[model samples]
Target chain A: MKVGFFVGCNTAFNRPDLEKAVRYVFPALGIELDNLEGQSCCPTWGTMPSIDLVGWCALGARNYAIAEEKGVDMITVCSTCHGSLARTAYRMQTSPEVRNKVNELLKEVGREFRGTARIRHAVRYLYKEVGPDEITKLLKHRLDGLTVAIQPGCLSLWPKEVFIDKEEDTFHPKVLRELCEALGVSAPHYKQLLECCGMGGMRSTDMEKSFRLVERKMTSMKKEINPDLIVTGCSSCLIQFDTSQEFLQKKGRIYFEIPVLHYMQVLAICLGAEPKMVTGLSRTPVDNIIKRILQG
Target chain B: MKIFEDLQTTAEIALVKNNLAEEIKELGADKLLQCNQCAKCAATCPLVLAGFPFFNKRIIQAILIGARETLLNDISIWACQSCNRCTDLCPRNVNPYEVILATRRMAVREYALPALAVEGIRSLYDVGHAVYLSESGNPRRKLGLPEKPPTTLSFSNALREVQAIMRKTVLADLGIIPMEESANF
Candidate 1:
């Protein structure tokens, strides 16, 4: 099985370690990942999509055309990418006029969005395609005695009808939870599990307000489950949760810290990828957790 | 920017009737009339939870009252995470999130966007990604990957394709960012 890798912005620039984790995990499990050669951003919420509908769909269609030529679906660890690309595809597939205008924009670039390829979130892809059973069979390490609070990044699950992979009950998504469980960890519920991580537009606009959201989620995680680690399926969520703690602590808003990792980073460690490459760039330290995962 | 400061009196509401709502609908919130002020969207919106003065319901309220300048002058619209939780939970099928986005489009036309949003658009035009870090080379190389991940950064031609596509969009007329004609795409 092979797929195109659409490495979105935050993953490539803000946290390349997550990129390394994805690179390490996919091939280790016998799924070949194509770079998709010329993929770009999802154009994220703050950019094209917010500016013009055709521009957003045009950029997305260009990326989709690259994957279509390869005759495989595209996948990304970033939920923003999953949301952007999937929503664009849904728009074009449903509206002929939108597709025509987008295709006209793509026509200048010598490409066309045939609406053939779909964008898949890497975690959801693993959950549905690889299955937890096949995943456990390939692991080199396990997370026994570990408890986690899952941040099922808002974009990956919501506006549910537009996405390729969806939670049966979007209000209560379980894909990220079950994926964490496959690693031998106990993933539990948190009250603010579905809240936005204050990334994208919110973070870019007013970080104080952004931190308000993440701090609320963090407080809930610390109080309700008080899990050993925070596992999220979105790259932007990883950046927000992993980096905002120090500021939150400095403000005396929160009294504690919790280590955060994207699910792929944790999977990479379990697959025995070097910790330095897979999880090194985290802001909230993961030293003790890494040590524990390696010892077992 | 207190929202109630822009609250329309009965006479003022008669003078400005549904103008902003029509503009929002044309921008992409085509289902503007469907919203019945259910406030179901407001109940679940992160913007509301984060205490933004104008959230899904309030933003709609602002639009219905033709508070164009009131909506534009404030940064609350920019703070929307676009998580679409409001869209997901809305009983009216209003897709309140699109209304937020449509409001953003209206702001862009009036040059009311935040500097960071402008920076993001500038960055997207230059790098084919909205969030490009010039200092990412060392971290990427330290991880045994290329200096630039295989994106438009690694492929100059792809960057040109992105620029060409950008040129054809509304961005061209807005002139929010510099889109030089360097590529034949």
Candidate 2:
């Protein structure tokens, strides 16, 4: 199957490995991955409710419009962008009043929103389409000694109106964990597997509250079980946990230098991509995770 | 602590929000008509599990009666993790998640607690960026930032620019004011 990749602004700028990992894994699964240019932020300003919602909607609609032009299904790596674009599409199609209003606004800039495309996050597309059995068959690397704590951010679940899927029993689905196991690793169990990374407006607005939230979760992860890495499904959470550890350490919180790998990035390493290519060193805690995955 | 029943006048707050959002009036009043106070939402709420005082049924009742003061002051709304566990588990799709986020947005405006919302909004107003990275006159080289922070636009100035666009958009009729103009008041 041919798919159009909506490389979100964060992934393009900061977490390039998420994009690289996707490129590496899908070809193995017999899927042709394509990237489109001029894709912008879905601009989820509505999360604050104080920002201009129309501006956000217009920006997001522009993205969907670009993807629709390609005449292929669009896939996004960022859950935040996926949720925003999906909600905009739903609102535009379902509410004629809203569609007319948004279309009217877009007319001024010569961009009319036709709302013809469907957007899916990479995680959802991978699991539902690729299947656990296919993922198991493709594993070439064995990750025997390593254990992982699965962390999925809020945008991936909840607010069911946008997600439109039956809530899975495991927030961080066993699919990713099972994929890891197929590649040879032990998955750790944790209670609040579905907790927010405090990176939402909470972290950007209130550092103390945000840090306290992450600190609390990290502390729990350390005290409860010492996993070899903290693998996550969201780019925002990766930044919050990966880059914010220094701030957490200054506040006297324990340092959890635990590697945070995107699920595809982990799979890439198992598929034998280079440490730099698979682990994404610049914005990741890659050393130990790459070592563990490769050594096994 | 006052529990809203003790408030002197809730009518004014209700009128302001209702005048802005008709759906608020419906959600605030009509939606709770079938509510039997089963406590199912409260019991299953992720917030309550996290020790937050969010009682889903109680919030619905409070909104129904136009008791904005009580609902605005409650910590239950912010405490919601937005995990939607309660909404999903609810026998009725009471949708506690939507209710809490709406109420919290209203409360942020009502209480003028933009500062309480996060330092980001304030910084976004003061400087172009989201947070207050440094002081106004601090040497740019010392901080290691790329350059000096952007100029500080007055809160009102920033609000005016955002409001101008919101006024013409579909969002204008949504009843959310976008920003609390006189938060100090």
Candidate 3:
């Protein structure tokens, strides 16, 4: 299957390894990724209510327009982009009134959205096209000696219909568990595994709310389930847990020094992909485990 | 502030009279009517488990009885991580997260909530991405990402899809459809 790639802002920059891993594993599994260099950010998290909603819709619609222009299906690495584009496609495809109104607004700017493409996040792409059983067969090594917790940020789930089947419930989404099994790791049960990182739009202004939310997750991880690393699918969750852990430590509630990583990095490890190639580890504290997996 | 003051009260009807009632009925009040308020939803809520005072049953009961005042005035609604744990576990299917979302939406419509609260909503425009980063430099470069070409979306396709839906749904009368593909397809 030929799948087009929409590299989200975070992956393209801080987490380039994710894109690298995608390139590494996807094609090998018979999934061809066509990169549309013109693809833009999902812009859902950047929006503030004070700004016009019509404009956000236009930006999101513009992304779809680019993919349609390429005459290929859209596959986004970022959960937020997937949600934004999916919501835009659904609204535009299902509600002509909204479509017309939005188009009227876009017309003033010379952008038109005909809704020709379908949007799928990378998780869905892997689950649906690659299949877990197929992915399991590709593992180069086992992820033993690792007690990882699965953190599926809100963007990945909730709009449940748009995603792949979870291996478990929203809190214990089986997607990551299945991914872990294929990679040879033990995914222990953890509370709030699918909770929000609390670093949504509020991270900029309301630092306290963001901290409070992160602290809660960290505290729970310490008291409830202690894992060597916290595995995540969302960049924002990576930011909240990996970056925010420093903040929580200052408050004298340091339960653990867990490193958070994108699940793709784990997949790359199983596929024998290098650690340095995966991005977003500058702040992560679990370098040893990752390096151990890579070296072996 | 005053919004929080009015919301901290116990009287539902009185809170509504204080103009704290949102355009949409908030969650947590209908418990007496249909909800047993047994704490099951809260027990399952990711936010609650994460240590926030976020209770799905409380929010549900508040909204079931038209306690718009309390729902509108409360700040917990804003703290929802949108995990939707309550939506999945709600034996009654009350969808407290949606109620909280609606309440927040109403708050956003009437008064300016926190700027970040609206950032997700505003991100559709100004910056191509949702979380506002510096607009001056290349976004990819600023975030330590590899530089890439800017992207463009097809306006016509989305417009057609929206138009088709408008024709089918009740939204047809509003003429909310875009005027032309170039301007409002």
DockQ of each: 0.72, 0.10, 0.18
lDDT of 3 by residue, A237-270 (tens): 7767878777677777674578877777677767
Question: In model 1 chain B, where is the ten-residue run with the lowest total lDDT?
Answer: B2-11
Ranking by DockQ: 1, 3, 2
Tell me the deviation in Å of residue B185 in model 2: 38
Q: Residue A50: error of model 1 in Å?
A: 1.5
Task: Give a tens-digit lDDT track for model 2, residues B68-126.
Answer: 77775655555444455565556555555556555655665454344544554433332
Count of clashes in candidate 3: 80
The candidate maximizing DockQ is: 1
- iRMS, all models: 0.9, 8.6, 7.3
Q: What's the C-alpha lDDT at position B128 in model 2?
A: 26
TM-score of 1: 0.95
Regions of candidate 1 where Cα sits further than 4 Å from its true position = B1-16, B183-185
Considering only N, C-alpha and C atoms within 3 Å, which residue pairs clash in candidate 2?
A143-A184, B28-B64
Find the candidate with the highest TM-score and give its number: 1
After the best TM-score superposition of candidate 1, give how far the Cα of residue B37 lies from its true spot, in angstroms. Answer: 0.5
Q: What is the TM-score of each candidate against the true structure?
A: 0.95, 0.70, 0.71
Q: Which order, best to worst by TM-score?
A: 1, 3, 2
Residue-wise lDDT of candidate 1 within A154-233, one digit each (tens)?
A: 88988899988788999978888888888999998888887888887888777888889999999998999999999999
Relative to the real complex, the DockQ score for model 3 comes to 0.18
Q: How far is candidate 1 from the true structure (C-alpha RMSD, Å)?
A: 3.9
